[model samples]
Target: MKLRAYLLMLAVVGIWGCTFVLIKDALSDASPLAFNTVRMTLAFLVLAIAYRRHWREINRHQLIAGVIVGFFLAAGYQFQTAGLAKTTPSKSAFITGLVVVLVPLFSTVKALRPVGARAPRWNAYLGAFLAFAGILLLTVPAGSGVLPDFNAVNSGDLLTFGCSVAFTLHCIALGHTSPRIAFQPLALLQIGFCALFMMISTPILEHPQMRVTPRLILALAIAAVLATAAAFSIQSWAQSILPATHTALILTLEPVFAWITSFLFLGERMGLRPASGAIIILAGIAITELIPQPHVPTSHEA
Candidate 1:
C-alpha cells in the first residue's frame, strides 16, 4: 500500500509539472484569476458527477476540513497562476517547489503541537536542505553565477514564494484531514470550495478576461480533467497513506519534470547549472528513500 501510494504521488506530481507550461501558454489568452476560476470550476464539475453518490455522506467535519484545505489550495493556485504571468515557467515551478522545505518546517513547528505535530525524521531535514540548494541552483540564470542574487528578486518570485507557503499549508491540512474523511467526499468538497473561492475572487482581484480560442479550450480541458480533477483525487487518497513530509519530498521532482517538459515542448533550453540542480534534487529524494530510519527503544526495553 505504501509503495502504491508513493507511485500514485509520483504520477500526480508529474501531471502537475506538465501544467506549468500549459498554464503559461493559457495565460496568454486569459487573466490569471479568470483562468483559475474556469479550470477549477470545470474540475469541480467533473468530480461532482463522479462523486455524486458521496454528497449525502458529507458531514460537518468534512465540510470544515474541505473549507480549510480548499482555502489554501485556492490561494496557492491564485498566486501561482498570477506569478506565472510575470515569471518564466521554470522559475515559477522552482519557486513553488520550495514547499518541499516549508512542509517539514510547518509540520514540526512547536506551535502546531496541539494539532498532532511531530518532528520529522533526520533524513527529511537533510533532504529538504539539499532540495532547497537545488532550487537555488535552478533559479539562478544560466550565466549569472554560482548563487542567485537575493536583491534582484522580483514581485513574481515573491508571489510564487507565497504559493509555496500556501501549498505547504495545504499539504499539512490534507495530511491531517484525509485520514479521517472519506477520500471521495473530501476530494469533491475541497475541489468544490476551491472553485467557489476562485469564482468569488476573480472579479474582485482582477478584471476577469478569457478568449475562447482553441488553445484556451485545450489547456482548460487538460488542466481541469487531468491535472486538477484526477491529480487531486489521487492526492487526497495518497496523503491518507503518506506522511506530509514524504509526500512533499516526492513533489520536489515537479520542477525537474516541468523543466524537461518546457525544454522538449516549448523549445526552452536548460543550462549546465540547471541540469546539475535537477540531479541534486534527485539525490535529495534518494537520500530520504534509501536511508533506513534509526530504531528507537520501546518503553519496555528502556
Candidate 2:
C-alpha cells in the first residue's frame, strides 16, 4: 500500500512537472482564462465519458459543492497559467508549494483548534525548511537587472500564488465531499464549473484575441487530459488513505519536479541560487510539519 501510494504520487508529480511548460506554451495562443476553461472542458469530457453511470449518483448538494470547488480550481489554474508567462518555472513551482504550509492553518480555522489534535511532526518541518530555502536561492536573480515588472507582475508567478491558495482550500473541501457521490461525477461537475468561470472571465479582463493553432490545441489537450485528470485522480486516491499532512508534504515536491522537467524540455533553467532557495522552502515547510505531531490519528478521528 505504501509503495502504491508513493508511486501514485510520483506519477502525479511527473504529469504536473510537464504542466508548467504546457501552460506556458498554451498562453501564446489563448488568454489565461480561455486556456483554463478550454482545458477543463476537455477534462470534463474525458471524465464524463468514463463515468456515465456515476452521474445519477451525484446529488444536488454534491453539484453545488462541486461547482464551488470547481470555481476555485479554475481560479487557481487561471492564475498559475498567467503566472507561467512571466515567471520562471522554478520560481513559480516553489511559490506554489506554499499550499503545503497552508493546509493545517485552514484545518485549524475550520475546527477552532490545531489540526491532528496535536503539534506537527519534526521531520515534516525539516523537509519544508529545506524546500523553501532552495526556492529563495532560486528566485534571487543572478544579477541586479532581474527585477520583476511591477505593473503586470510576473503573470505566471502571481497566478501560481493564487493556484496554491485555491488548491489548499480545494483539499479542505475534499474532506467534506459526500462518500455517497462518486469521484468522477463530482470532479466532472467541478470541471464544468471551472470552465464556465474561465470562459466568462477571459473575455472581460484580457480581451485579447486568440488565434489557435495545432500546437495550442495539442498543449491544451495534454493539460486537460493528462495533467488535470490523471494527476488529480492519482492524488485523490493516494491521499485518501494517507495522513493529510503527509500527503500534503509529499505534494510539496511538485515545483522541484516541474523545475527539473522544464529545464530538460522547455529550456527553462534554474541556477544554483534559486535551486538552493527551493531547498530552503522545502526545509521550512518540513519544519512547520515535523515540529508538532503528537501521535497517530485514530481512524474514527480521521
Q: TM-scores across all candidates?
A: 0.82, 0.80
* Per-residue lDDT value at 108 in model 2: 44
Query: Which residue pairs show backbone clashes in model 1?
Result: none
Local distance difference test, each candidate: 0.75, 0.66
Q: What does candidate 2's lDDT look like per residue over 1-302, in tens digits?
A: 97899888767776676677667766788776667767878888888887788888877888888887777677677776777777876677778777666554545454523233544444645555565445445544444457532453344555676777777666555545534456777777877787788878877877655668988888887787877776667776776777756765566677778778778877876566655677778776666655443322111000
Question: Over 4 Å off in model 2, which ranges?
Answer: 1-5, 111-155, 178-180, 241-246, 288-302
Q: Candidate 1 regions off by >4 Å? A: 1-11, 111-117, 140-148, 235-250, 272-302
